[model samples]
Target: MSRDNPTSLEQRLSVHLQPLYPDEDPARMAQACLEAMELSPSATPVKPHANLWSERDTVVITYGDSIRREAEAPLQTLRQFCHDHLSDCISTLHILPFFPYSSDDGFSVMDYTTVNPALGNWDDIETLSAEFKIMGDLVINHCSSRSLWFDNFRQSIDPGASFFYCAPGDADTSMVVRPRTSPLLREVETPDGVKHVWCTFSHDQVDLNFENPDVLYEFIKIIRLYLEKGIRWFRMDAVAFVWKKLGTACINLPETHELIRLLRLLIEHKAPDAVIITETNIPNHENLTYFGNANEAHLIYNFSLPPLLLNTLITGNCTHLKSWLMTMPPAQFGTTYLNFVASHDGIGLRPTEGLLSEWEVDTMISTLQRFGAKVSCRTNAQGEPKPYEINISLWNALQGTAQHGPDTWQYARFMCAHAIMASLEGIPAFYIHSLIATENDYERIENTGHFRSINRHIWDADALSDALQDTGTHHHKVINGMRRLLEIRCKQPAFHPNATQFTLHLGESLFAFWRQSTDRRQSIFAIHNISDQPQSLNLSELNLVSTDQWTDLISEQHFEDRVAQLELAPYQYMWLTNL
Candidate 1:
């Protein structure tokens, strides 16, 4: 980037890609462009209320449910929940993967056409999509090995199939079996004489070869049809691994990026209403590449945020979050982040960029990885630490049924984490189960043959909801506390963007940031302490006149900014309104 600046994707690509792509054949180049289409095909209809993103502004509660196997069950709850928590503030609903998928938590989608029958019928999806203005997220990166696409690719490589990508004769067998860091690995097998085929996470899940133009075309068709049915967002699952060429890590490939661009183009040309949000579980710098100058995805899931939030809590720091903020380069002014702390998945150690110093990261992530490793815990009659895996010690540090931080420190810290999130640079999203504190650390659902559904649970949602509905329960206290922050955030104008300057007081574990809209019409500031101990701040350095008198939205509490320091309870947050 210094003296030899590469101007185009092809130019930047040629250096490392010449070995694979060879020359720029127009056909291949066109295919590459189609793969990352910025707009949908011209044949696609431009319908209303389909891709309303920034205009359809809402502070949504994004729940990463597997699918609509039984739509009536969750759909009903979703409708009700929407009306209650999100109806006014959130106009768009993101139901993650309502279609049937393979064991890898539905990323191995079997059929992209309809919601799996296990969840509900096609009619149910239509009903749900029609009943209320909601956004449905369809996973479109990989497919289950059992899918018709994979069947054709292996047992019957029919040219007219218009579905799967068949390797040229011996290519499938020719590819090597290796463990690649990236999720998409080329893996197929010769099962009892009939050679099966695919690029996949595992042998069970097969990746659709987008290299085949027909496969690309059919995938686009699926997007357009969903647009007709009111699906507003398509989350590209494992999207970075879409294009694979041996040797190099098959990730963030030029072709993969091109594919997203083409999809965006086709969507813009056809539907023009729905938004494409890429689910690249990478760091802020890498994730921003998904925007492709606003030609790829309209939004992206801030996958680093959850761990970033939790890390800030455990380490009593905001430096990493602030540093990442400075490095995040979004495509345009209007793009937003689908922000949340927890989703359907476990806390992934991703975005391993400059979040922490190399030594610190190695120490911290090694510690986290150790926490996740299999461990047998034993306790004495008095219930204290005994012989166990190192994971248990680290796990307990995160409030695993034992006192690690302080009394109610975990709960208070957790609540403040959410409050701070709700006040971050983007629309703060909450996983419904996390609100009620669904702390099911029951790890081994994978052993019951439901390997992928290990973390999946119906949840004791009714009890939590009812308790919150009742005024006196702890559930009410927690939910209302979260509700208060959310309700206040909705009224303020500053938190609408995803990129903003952060001001941190390192000693107090406090973070402050203001998102000033480009037009300067609105600005919002969030103040938070990640520490377990009570902290205070003196803003004489911040140059605010009488930092003493300011409007605090969270509890409707007023503060008088004076030369004297203002006190903050442990894990307290302030939503301040000012220029």
Candidate 2:
């Protein structure tokens, strides 16, 4: 351990490994772990030089197979589109789980070392990385049962027998937080005998046993493989349930935080600019624990924002949202939140557990369901079904009294929602579907029998190009609107992740906030009318300044004198800054 900093990796690894291997030599274990961090002598990796956690950084989350062409690989078409269309607005591309998978839309990864052959090869990934920084998912919680590791485990090989968790039948294991209503112990036949292994997500996705140091070392190698391929940001998927203990909720455990910190240190040591963002979709208080003294995740997903934002729009109120934001703990200097409205998965409701009332949540779920959204449920400890997530495109989620199909009012509403998201005090991520302004693909859901497929639409390259060229189309309106917003957002230093946020409690039908730059030289006042009806903003009470020289950046309009009172059209927003 270093004499200057006792909390360094050497000291922390010793403490973290003691409980897992009580009798083993901690010094030897730490040495082995450090040895694994070194790259193979024959390998030649690219030099990484991407800076993360910047105000100009806006992430676009998509799948490698999202956009396709007739003969070209999907990833190739995606890269072409990024170069030809989105190169200016998007700074980072978050390709979701591009590895080979068996089910769950790449969540059940069969091979972590290779890309899905159907969606281009490593050449395509490297090409995209050359243009824009890439973020990849480290789905380390579980692996596909069809993977070679699982097969070898079934054969009871020396190294494979201890790769996954196969618990004893007599062991006491009752208290566990189940994300899905699935069986905890899955029965499988090994060469030795029948075994019941821990399957946290699904029977097809078996959880690995971290109790074995071999698994940890193997994951370290997998991460290095990604680093060699040019992944600057790593998203840890479903990591809350990574470490488990009997007679407990099996989430946010002490071991889990230590493991995250350990990974953070190793990655920072390897690539000084590399960033790790944890995707823990739990409650607010529990999720913040991942930023353990700035030694864990550089960013944690703002899971509460989606549902709470929905509640604000649906109920025509921002009271709860304001209260939640006021209570949100500020991030450390280098760590911030990954704010997003929609992603590959559904809009999570668990993050809004205490922020919203039961009736309020019921109303949100019911309203979205009326607008053609699907709801997924999880079983509580009392064996009752509870709403877990609302699966729908964000465009449809914000649709209210605008008629279902393509309409200007619907587009305006979507833009308003995005404006509020962009003004938030963190890096804003837009889902690929949301960026293109596409609606629910009911045909996809009917054909695949997967509800999440509604938002996960497989787009054609030529059709997307045609739609973008046509100004009247849905894709053009939403994509261009977002591009303009990002253009202005990137130029504003007040939108930095470390900016200070002050909630302005105007009323129920409006959500307003002021974001000031860290140096306090620049500020932006963002106001949004969440309701369908027009509302008036009282400027007399705001006391912004002595003069009325303010400019609306979104509309590019200047206000000189009549700033006493202003009216906001239905679902309208403005980003006002002193000129």
Candidate 3:
């Protein structure tokens, strides 16, 4: 083609995207942007993606009230503790969302840009952000509804501020919202007439209107603000409902994906290393969307693991656990799963809600129904169970915490979970209290009248003197066990995630799998007995030529001779390192 009718590379690429992002300046959009990465042709497809997390790389996470005041601040001490023990192995740290929210924990925010003075001043946050940044990884996600952007959307009386999406033009309608399913009904007074806004889970969390270009820009500014402070990861909080359309469940909309991709494109051009993590609390099926092209979230939470981990504890069995493990897909092979036993919010009854039989969910819902909890999604109309709040309390109370004794039935349940979470297939997270086996803050719930009690207790690393499995003080064992696992994992590069996992089922109680590297230098195999009774197994099935002298990383013990048979103690665990 002649120069006048040229189909040059620059023109071709420019014309390709000009129509879609018309608002983005074409000249600026042509500026260097990060290319989407796919597996290299030379790379093996079966290998697991390497870990962004390393035992020696340092991990920093923030939690509790960033707004907590008049309380002896533990953030400084926590930082010191992380530095003291981790030194180099763990590097990046993430703080929980402390943006101003409309109760229901801090999940729903009222203003995004403003720091909730209760946690600390913006100066304090900036100071801390600097401290963490210079030392290593510091990250915070753009907040929920509490953001100024959302506030503008929720801002009625001002038609000029179209930053947020309102429910039709009905800000004033009369409707009573029973916060809980109990008889205590609360009026949600709206403008004009008191009409109730669809809270979905709670009454206050009004969805934002991302359709407005202003809201998108505001979030971009929010992202830039945190990045300016040296935050490396931004946890995209509650992203499932970001963009909604009519006649749909108003979730995971096409616009939502477009919005996320656009944000990703922006981040790629500006902050290449900055990572986005999605905090969707749905099952694995729904949660997978967050990892959009591996470009969306650098990591996604392993939410499904918790309840199943709990179920394994109660039944002392691994069948269900094995099945779930099989369902895990390699959206992007080798990417890390942010595994956790507990988090800032309450434990959700997700993932498994789809897997479990209706009868099982019904039974649990009925139990909660008897307690005045109203169940939704996974529950029937016969029971008005408060699935949201009660699930949180019940999960925390029943775990192998110091709250209940060995005879309390919940004792073994807690212990069983301990073994599973520490050995699971992802980056395991330790809830502040869960680390020390802190008991459930039942009184906090009773006092707060909401889930904020989940965040009430202070974290004292040295306060616990109880045994790891000692009733409620189960934290010591769990921490050390996790530390030891990570330590062993770091010793071998093969554990770095370029490996494949092959699972083996030896009866219902014994669950075993190996994270095997191609070179076989760091093939790590773990066997767990989530059973009330001891399990004995044959070695022929596992391809182990020599079973003598296999080291138990957590207990620091060595077991000799499983050439013929291997025995697992009740609620036992084993991690074998390959030569």
Q: Indicate which candidate wins on TM-score.
A: 2
User: How far is 454's C-alpha from truth in model 3 (Å)?
Assistant: 4.5
Evaluation by lDDT, superior candidate among 2 and 3: 2
Per-residue lDDT of model 3, residues 1-579, tens digit only:
232352433332234234435576533433322122221212222212334454233233446342222354444544555555444344455666555566655656666565555555455555555545321111122234444543433444442145434464334322322223432112333343432334444445554455554445456666666666566666776676665544455556665665565565455445555555676777678788777666456677888776666555545666877898888874365356777756556556655667766665454444434433333332223434435423343334443322122334343445446445545555555554554445556466677765546444654444433344354454655556445555655565434433566777677888778776546555556777776667897666665547334565656665455555777776667776545
Better of 2 and 3 by TM-score: 2
In model 2, which regions exceed 4 Å deviation?
1-9, 39-51, 170-173, 401-408, 547-549
lDDT of each: 0.56, 0.83, 0.52
Candidate 2, lDDT over the whole model:
0.83
**lDDT of candidate 2 at residue 179, scale 0 to 100:** 70
| Candidate 1 local lDDT, 1-579, one digit each (tens) | 221564343333233333334454544544454454433122343342232443225434344342122334555555665567555555556666667777655556777787765555556556666645455655555677777667655544563233444344344332332222232234444332443344545666666666655666577667766877776667677787677665455568788776776566556665556677787776567777887766677778877777666677767777887666556553365466777776655554455455756565445544444334322222322334322221211122344111133346655776777776666665555665555444344354544343223334454445546767888765567666666556666655555554354555445378776655545555455778777667877755443445335566765665565444778887787766553
Candidate order, TM-score descending = 2, 1, 3
Q: Score every model by TM-score.
A: 0.78, 0.94, 0.75
Ten consecutive residues with minimal summed lDDT in candidate 1? 387-396
**Ranking, lDDT, top scorer first:** 2, 1, 3
What's the distance in Å from true for residue 245, model 3? 0.8
